[model samples]
Target: MTAYIALAVVVVIVIWAVAIYNRLRTYKNQVENAFAQIDVQLKRRHDLIPNLVEVARGYMQHEAQTLEAVIRARSTAVSAADEARQSPGQAQAMGALMVAEQALVGQMGRLMALAEAYPTLKADARMQQLSEEITSTENRIGFARQAYNDQVLDFNNEASQFPDLIVARLAGFAHMEMLQSTQNEQERAIPQVKF
Candidate 1:
């Protein structure tokens, strides 16, 4: 009777451990999938930057500084993103990438403000189309970032919880930081440009 009870206890413990391991694995994969969504949107935004810069070059001749800032920011953002891709689970790399991304967005906003001064540039069909596309891509990136953050939060919570924390350690599940936008309230607000 004693031997039978011991065997049953061992089987139950093995099943529980397997279940927890599978749960952690699933959560980790979800985090990766969510990050992939952000990657796709960021790639779209990066591709649009050069076209926008090229279109503005002709009209914003005097505003070369602003255009250069945009290009420089884009380069930094791309490099940071590549680093994050190589180490997605590392909070340091991911944080740096998000900070770079926000810097790029700020430069883009500055370029937009400069473009506003050039009525001709704003009126040009190509510039207008590019602006619209870039705006759409930004929205997509925001949504993707939000989804990724949600996954990170869920995973973090799971990893921090009592029983799961033990499982997480044994399974090599590390804590992840949410991909955050460093935009201030003013930066987040829409600029009201008068014609």
Candidate 2:
């Protein structure tokens, strides 16, 4: 009777551990899939940027500095994105990517503002089309980032739970960093409207 009871207890423990391990594995895979979706959108956004610059270059001959800044920012962002793709959940890589992307966005905004100053560039058909594409791509990237962060939250919750934490640690499942807003404090500040 003692031996039978001990065997049943061992079997139950094994089954419980296996279930936790499988759940953690599923969560990890979902996080990776979510990151992949973000990667695809980022790639699309990056690809459109050079064409945007080229179209603006013809009319904005005086804004060489702004155009160069955009190109440099884009290059940095591309490299950071490649690093993040290799290790999506890594804190350092994600941090670098966020910084680079923020710089790129700021530069792009400056370029667009300069474009608005030159009516000829603003009215060009190709310029208008590329701007529309970039805006669309930006929206897609936002959706993808939200989905990635949601998956990261779910994975972190599961992995950090008491009993599951044991399995997560044993199986080498680490917590993932969520993609946060790239906006700086100044950008996030609400504008004061004066009458």
Candidate 3:
């Protein structure tokens, strides 16, 4: 009878371990999936930058500093993504990437506003195409960022919960930061710009 009880206890422990293992794996997958969404958006932005620079060059020849900033920022942003190929575990590494990403976003915003300064560029066919691409890509980025944050939130909750947290700690569950958004999420509810 005692032998049977020991066997039953061992079986129960094994089953419990497996259940916890699977739950943690599911949460980790969610985080990876979220980052993948972010990757697609970032890649789109990277691909669009060259076209944008080419389109704006003719009309904005006099605006060399602005053009240079856009190129420099894009380069840095792309490099940063490469650096963060994995979800960053170190705080400083993450911070550096965030700074680069924000710089890119700011530079892109400035690029769009450049349309106001260069009337000729605004009217050019290539510039117009670039503008359309920027607008579409920006909308997609916003969507993907939102999705990533949502996933992060779900993962975070699981990592912090009662029973789940127990498993989470054992499974190497460290908190992942949500996309550090500038605007309040509620304000980005539309996620699109008309211009």
Report the number of the highest-lDDT candidate. Answer: 2
Report the lDDT of model 3 for residue 35.
72
- lDDT at residue 181 of model 2 (Cα atoms): 70
User: If scored against the real structure, what TM-score would every candidate get?
Assistant: 0.90, 0.93, 0.84
In candidate 2, what are the lDDT values of residues 74-112, reduced to their tens digit? 999999999999988888989999999999999999999
Clashing pairs in 2: none
Candidate 3 regions with alpha-carbon error over 4 angstroms: 88-94, 182-195
Tens-digit lDDT track for model 3 on 1-195? 999999999999788877876876786687677677777878888888888887787777777798799899889888887776566423454566678878887877777788677788788888788778867877877787787678777778877888778777887888877667633355459767788
Q: Which portions of model 2 show Cα errors greater than 4 Å? A: 191-195
Q: How large is the C-alpha RMSD of every model relative to the true structure?
A: 3.2, 1.6, 4.2
Provide the overall lDDT of each model, using Cα atoms, as 2-decimal numbers.
0.88, 0.92, 0.76
Residues 17-105 of candidate 1: C-alpha lDDT, one tens digit per residue:
78888888888888888888888888889999999999999998888898999999999999988888876757999988988998999
CA lDDT, candidate 1, residue 125: 99
Give candidate 2's error at residue 126 in angstroms: 1.0
TM-score top scorer: 2
Q: Could you tell me which 10 consecutive residues in candidate 1 have the lowest summed lDDT?
A: 179-188
Instruction: Report clash pairs, candidate 3.
Output: none
The superposed Cα distance between candidate 3 and the true structure at residue 35, in angstroms, equals 1.5
